[model samples]
Target: MDKRLIVVLVVFLFVLWYALRTAQIPPASIQASAEVFYINNETVTIVEKDGWGLFTLEVKPRISGFTFEIEFPEGTEYLIKVNGKEYRGNTTFKTTIDKDSEIYINFRLPDEDTKKLYRGEGQYYLTIKASKLPIWYVEYKIKLIPRKEKD
Candidate 1:
């Protein structure tokens, strides 16, 4: 089996896991029993951030006949937040693991961007506008924790 292909499969699975979580017990309710958000005819799983450390989440959906890209909108600005504040994106994170062993990328975003966070937990949020032309789904993941107190 191709190594790269395997990696992609693993990451896809992880993204799928995170994406489904929102549908399983989403905070808001949807009219359709199987369908949730409509993004380019895809289901985006979104969840509130709760904790820290190697937080991996999946963004792709595992449903059939679904069509959409996990990538964010074209003109949207993305920033990772940790514990309610802007995170230094310089923190090194690799997509290779996300593509292989990880179900989601172990990327650490700042949590200070959100104040409604739960203690001992972290939250990450993605801000973007909905595409009016083709109904689209937005799958967002959140992870929060203190900056690894610089050594």
Candidate 2:
């Protein structure tokens, strides 16, 4: 056997081993889920099942309200629920792909009612239901800290 050929074969084997070792294998379930929680600004990628592409969810927190926006793939429709209740007025908030897949929701926080309901800190649940795909749900906890009064 040629010395150069043996060296080439050894290098190829190492590369193959490295590639396999670093590769990430997704879960086997038909549904996949991811979550991101932030106080101010953040972007989260929602991966679809069966190796489909991902979508982005952008969250922005402001002094008065919190904003949520979702950018989904084409030809997809979705419904959102907050804390086991449907968001806003609609029975089911729906959005289609042909139009903008980005859906936005804004909520005012720390109000008297909200403070009483949350009791300073509590867990909140969010559910995203694709019209065709399986249901996906995420849970987040919020803590309210009292700020010291300026002297």
Candidate 3:
């Protein structure tokens, strides 16, 4: 091969390598206001005929893997949803005050899926429902951690 052609090829390869090495992926951005929600002694009654008791709370979560601790008076069936999406339980029930970290009455989203909540600032609804009646003193504590980015 000609010397000029060889030099040009080497230069091109070097430039390409430099460009690729220096390139950085932009960090994911979120307009989120981290917050914590607490529900103390809220009344919830589920008639035996209806078979379900329900309530909703508003919160803003900026990051994933948050802890949602809940508590109730007795053993009752219940379900919880965040913006219409069901929260997974640590064991049998996701949110038991209608659900705690210590006694395992907590709920949370996986790392991959929680981005939907951190996209922007808006009203995020957390709905808790019980399958039957008579467990009063429903308490819920939802702690949302703020996302910190490097400047």
Best by TM-score: 2
Better of 1 and 2 by lDDT: 2
Predicted model with the maximum lDDT: 3
What lDDT does the true structure give each of the candidates? Answer: 0.32, 0.33, 0.35
After TM-score superposition, what is the CA distance of residue 89 in candidate 2 from its true location, in Å?
Answer: 1.9
What TM-score would every model get versus the actual structure?
0.22, 0.26, 0.26
Clashing pairs in 2: none
Q: Candidate 3: lDDT over CA atoms?
A: 0.35
* RMSD value for candidate 1: 18.4
lDDT, residue 5, model 3: 98
- Whole-model alpha-carbon lDDT for candidate 1: 0.32
Please count the clashing residue pairs in each candidate, in the order shown. 28, 0, 5
Q: Candidate 2 lDDT (Cα, whole model)?
A: 0.33
- The TM-score, computed over Cα atoms with residue i paired to residue i, of candidate 2 is 0.26
Worst 10 residues of 1 by lDDT: 93-102
- What is the descending lDDT order? 3, 2, 1
Model 2: CA > 4 A from native: 1-92, 108-113, 133-151
26-140 per-residue lDDT for model 2 (tens digits): 2111122333334454323222222122222332211112122232222223444433334443222343222212333332322342343334453222334332212222223
What is candidate 3's lDDT per residue for 37-130, written digit by digit as tens? 2335432222221222233444323222333344422233445564455654332344322121112122333333234335433212233222
Deviation of model 1 at 68, angstroms: 8.2
Give the worst 10-residue stretch by lDDT in candidate 2.
Answer: 59-68
- Rank candidates by TM-score, best first: 2, 3, 1
